[model samples]
Target: MDDNQEASSTKRLWGARFKSEPSAALKALSRSEPSFFRLAPYDLAGSRAHARELQRAGVLDANELAQLLACVDEVEHAFVAGDLHPIEADEDVHTFLERVLTQRLGPIGGKLRAGRSRNDQAANDLKLYLRDKARTLATAIGDVQAALVAQAEQHIDTLSTGFTHLQPAQPIVFAHHLMAHAQAIGRNVDRLIDWDRRSARSPLGAAALAGSAICRSPELSAAELGYDASCENSIDAVAARDHVCEFLFITSMLAVELSRLSEEVVLWSSRQFQWVVLDDGYCTGSSIMPQKKNPDIAELSRGKAGRLIGNLVSMLSALKSLPLAYNRDLAEDKSAAFDSIDTLSLVLPAMAGMIRTMRVDVDQLRRHAPLGFTLATEVADWLALSGVPFSEAHEITGALVKFCEAQDIELGALTPAMLAEVDARLTPEVLKHLTLEAAIGARTGQGGTAPARVAEQIARLKAVLDKQAAWAADYRGPRC
Candidate 1:
């Protein structure tokens, strides 16, 4: 093509309404903002639904509708095979896709946008993209939970130290600690379910913040796209971005939970703890230090949590000043939201792999389980059960812990004379509760760290994972 034809070909779909092309600064911002290549399939799906809406409203004849559908199908296929790419003059995804369509099928393809605006079209595309991504993300989280539950199942009886404020405070089964993270992940799954249900509604027919004057058939498009219902208010449908914020919050919260667990993985794999040895395949060696094998996966997962939070905050900032109608600012929403999903897609399975392959040193865990006076709470409870008031029992246990610490003796190795030094009310029976195994077994309350309770909790987590796995596996629809 000649230079004039090439320049004209680069012109935007909305350029005819303007005197000349948009300013270079606006084009630069527009190019970076939407980043809608990822949203291409979603945009096409929305277009297919909208095309039929147009046909039903008699905006397109049967022949033109058939031609448009055929052309859009080819565009979708080229997009999927990575052959289609955007031009510089292509303003956004919508403009780029239209350029491709009009290039293939002439002006007939232009009728597909009848009675619709980029406002509702972009909003609908985001809903579709998030709905699919959320389902996949929920499944990735479930896989991580499954990995945790599997590891916990094997170590349900292995003893370990439970900490509060980064200090050892109690003795519990190691599986109990793993299951705590699994439970947090289960709640994250719950949050995804709630978020997906809210996002399942369609916003396609809400043209530009108002109901369309012609070619309106939201219900038809909603059903074609597998939405449960259309948005109740057109303006709210076009302008609403709270769903995006809520989705990012769920992702951010899930990241925080994983970061906490990742921190523990780092601590456990350290030489000081030596409680769990990460698989060599999952860990990395240092450049200079010959003895270094670092838990980089866990560390990176922890570090990437900040990225998720930043994405959430960036979206909130984008939504902060926008008015009810759609603004150019809303186009900035997809980049961060899509990146958050992409971040989790990388983090979750790698995290699961690290957990599933790690080696647990049961002997080491059991050995140090009772070293830090972790059984003090058990002794206090035993004293209380022996007719001493809990307040007095608490004081007695505190004195005993202090004495053991000062003498460099473990609570279990304390002499009867050492016990008598604290309180004459103490008897040999208290010694029974001083052992780590005894301390772990004594507390059998619901959700406690006892082995049996840990087993029961694992079973419960498996049930939750089972449900979420089915949800993840079945991508047909969630209306069931």
Candidate 2:
């Protein structure tokens, strides 16, 4: 069919015969062609399941089933090999695949749609597609987690300043801070895995917003397709794009987290901080300036997260006003979903590269990490232990901090005599507690930033990561 005729035919697929053509703007806005290529894998996967179901229901004899399966395989191979490109005139992947099958296998190929509607079929395809994508994304997240964990372990003994409200708060082992990020990403991976389980249902038999009258069993199709279950209701199956929304939500959250890390990279690589140095390969020089090794990749990762978040908001807005069942508005779903997936695919690997290559300047981190009287808490605790009221201890420490600031000396620089001049209760042993090592070592509580505590956390994180690796290895498509 010509492009206009093809567009008209697509409208016919809705079970209505329009007397006039669709307006050009509406046609363009409602077009599903860009999403067709992305939907092909889903179409192929669902077709495989349906072919098996047809065989089970006696709709196709064993010989005919063999021919049909072969034809499907050929189509998949051709599409993958780039010999069968999706036509712009095709309404969606479903239409394109049907057209290809009918053209290749003649009348026998037409039977593939016997008990299936685009409603259930499209839903099934999207589910299958997202299931696989989630698995792959889970792996990527795990890789990034592993990278962070490795860095944390390497820097466990490396002292750095931990900040609160953009000011140095305390001295901490750098690994302790890095491992916190690893734990956050590890949770993200778990979220994706949980979403995968929830999304692992087949919607392939909910034909045209209602259950099909055909004798075929959806359970059989679900089993063949590796879905955990068939969707319970026809209208809910076709109308529900919640799975896609959930996937996008998780991805958007992950993007936000990644952006936060990227912001740190950007700041650390700056001349003002210089605590971390990105590799020459990852760092780019400004075209106009001769002395600029810009953290462009990190900045880009941070910026791209906005796009991911925007896509999620756009999708939610699109679905908010729609009534029950499928609408042409639902065609808008793929662009947002596809954009999120594509943006994440780009971001995860780029971030992985940055993390793997970036260098942490231990000396620089140590020098500035201990600035701003970060050992003040240790001083307050010392006074509180010596029978001073906790609030009074805090005030006394603040006074000592102001005194040290006026003299251009750190709290550690104060001698026992100098400390005693400020607070008569101060002793030599109390001064020992002001040292950075003593301060950090005293905080040996569970989940503390002490070196030993960091080591313990790293060991636990390694065990969790190993279990995730095993799970990824054992995954054989979606579970039923």
Global CA lDDT computed for model 2: 0.79
221-280: candidate 1 lDDT, tens digit per residue: 898888888899999998999999999999999999999999999999999999999999
Candidate 1 lowest-lDDT run of ten: 1-10
RMSD in Å for all candidates: 2.4, 2.8
TM-score of 1: 0.96
Question: Model 2 compared with the native: what TM-score?
Answer: 0.93
**Candidate with maximal TM-score:** 1
C-alpha-based local distance difference test score of model 1: 0.85
* Pairs with steric clashes in candidate 1: none
lDDT of 2 by residue, 21-125 (tens): 667686566557564476676688788878878777777778877888898888787777767775555656777788777766777778888887887877777
lDDT, residue 298, model 2: 81
Q: Give all TM-scores, in the order shown.
A: 0.96, 0.93
